[model samples]
Target: MGSCASGTQVPKSTLRSGSRNPPFSTRPDLNLNTPWARSRSSWREEEPVTKPSRKLVGKCFCGAVRYEVADEFVYAANCHCSNCRRTTGSAFKPFAGIEREKFRLTTGDDRLLIFGEESGHDAHCGHCGSLLYSVVREGAYVHVAMGTLVDDPSIRPTAHIFVGSKAKWFTVTDDLPQYKGHVT
Candidate 1:
């Protein structure tokens, strides 16, 4: 676990209240600090814009990492890449791509373990190790783990990506288009 702090999550009331900003402040860009807990210059920050009337909520398996996301999605796909399979323990990982600003960590920001903390990385629960989402497109978008979402989103996987590297034993029965590589 990459967690250096306790897994306890701050309440919504105590956290920064607004539509554009998430309650948590570990992100380096936001620069908002919880005087009692976190400070500036911590982990990465996801850019969230204005709030919407409806939002989707998701959490890790152990209920340690909780988040809220805007219902809008840029794209959604099922990835058959080896890394996606290993992380989700499935033949493919069904994910929804949305802007970073649309997502917020409602609780358990300190409990997140980021893998490949660079241009793109996978955010997992430090405690239960739940694969939550992957920051991609130079950290501009998040391929959110659909399995973690508690509220249904408006989008669904319209295609399969990385089929060339997909598991040999698993068969794709769906009629959705299968791409040998990433969708263009």
Candidate 2:
């Protein structure tokens, strides 16, 4: 036995028996007894859900190239080596290291530039000449240029590396750990 929204008596056969929704007031499918009708709230799934992207986006200075990388990183540093300084034209380079598999070029593959050999190389944006990342550790890892990031990352530079080769014109004022050579 069942009752309609207005308290009118209805035989169980006239209603969708075992339907979980209350006596219908305005729902179109409220009387149907399909799988989705068993749960009163299943109708909410009619629209798809969208989650915010967790990966970080990076791009070249002229926006001619772009990439996406997982927010997770194994290490981060302020690199003061002469090579890094010259490539970036700065006193130091802020970079985050992660497995090469996690770093992907999302756009402008034709304009992508590789500056070194296969085992180790610097990835740059050919159009804007932006230093994007470095493939190191025998090509298993990549050190991403923090300057090219368009999204806030989960990690930040924690130490200064290769300080021995640091330019005399610049002085590190932060209290981060300083490594005389390179990090292992």
Candidate 3:
């Protein structure tokens, strides 16, 4: 009809009678005949996304005990005395003091196991015990055990030293700053 509109003959009842207008150029078809783009062909999907690697690593609880904390976390506490609730049975005792020269020992410091015979010395993991902390007898300091950090020591407690031997059924309504014993 007019030499079939000069080329790509738009005649099949005008391409099914203009199924609601289309036919604008050689490429302007993002609407790609809809239906979610005809079962997806190039809706852009190289599919990769995977970022989460701050390079933190921890062990113990069997693994013979390994450790690494290149940096981050200068404080993070919970304490609550009574010898930190009979040596961490819990009711407080988060700790994570850092800086005893950045703490290392990439694997079993000779099967690391200490446990205070006199004053304060914890440090566990003799093959799956896992405590890893306590050394403060003015030994410059070292008290990890913030649940054996490996990241999550984002930090929050700047104070709360002993709270008069705390644990009278655990209570601390949070306003921080509450030392009743040693804040030094």
Could you estimate the TM-score for every candidate?
0.71, 0.72, 0.33
**Would you list the C-alpha lDDT of every candidate in the order shown?**
0.85, 0.88, 0.67
- Steric overlap count per candidate: 2, 0, 0
Task: Arrange candidates, best TM-score first.
Answer: 2, 1, 3
Kindly give the stretch of ten consecutive residues in candidate 2 with the minimal lDDT sum.
20-29
Instruction: Tell me the tens digit of each residue's lDDT in model 2 across 98-169.
Output: 999999999997998899998899988888899999999999999999999999999999999999999998
* lDDT at position 88, candidate 1: 83
Q: For model 2, name the residue pairs that clash.
A: none
Name the lDDT value of residue 88 in candidate 2.
98
Top-TM-score structure, candidate number? 2
RMSD of 2: 7.7
Model 2 residue 84 CA deviation in Å: 0.2
Error of 2 at 38 (Å): 28
Candidate 3 Cα misplacement greater than 4 A, ranges = 1-50, 57-65, 68-76, 85-106, 114-153, 158-184
In the range 30-104, model 3's lDDT, one tens digit per residue, is 356777775564545645666753444666666788787644556766788887777667777877676565667
Q: Please, what's the RMSD in Å of model 1?
A: 19.6
Task: Please tell me which model should have the higher TM-score, number 2 or number 3.
Answer: 2
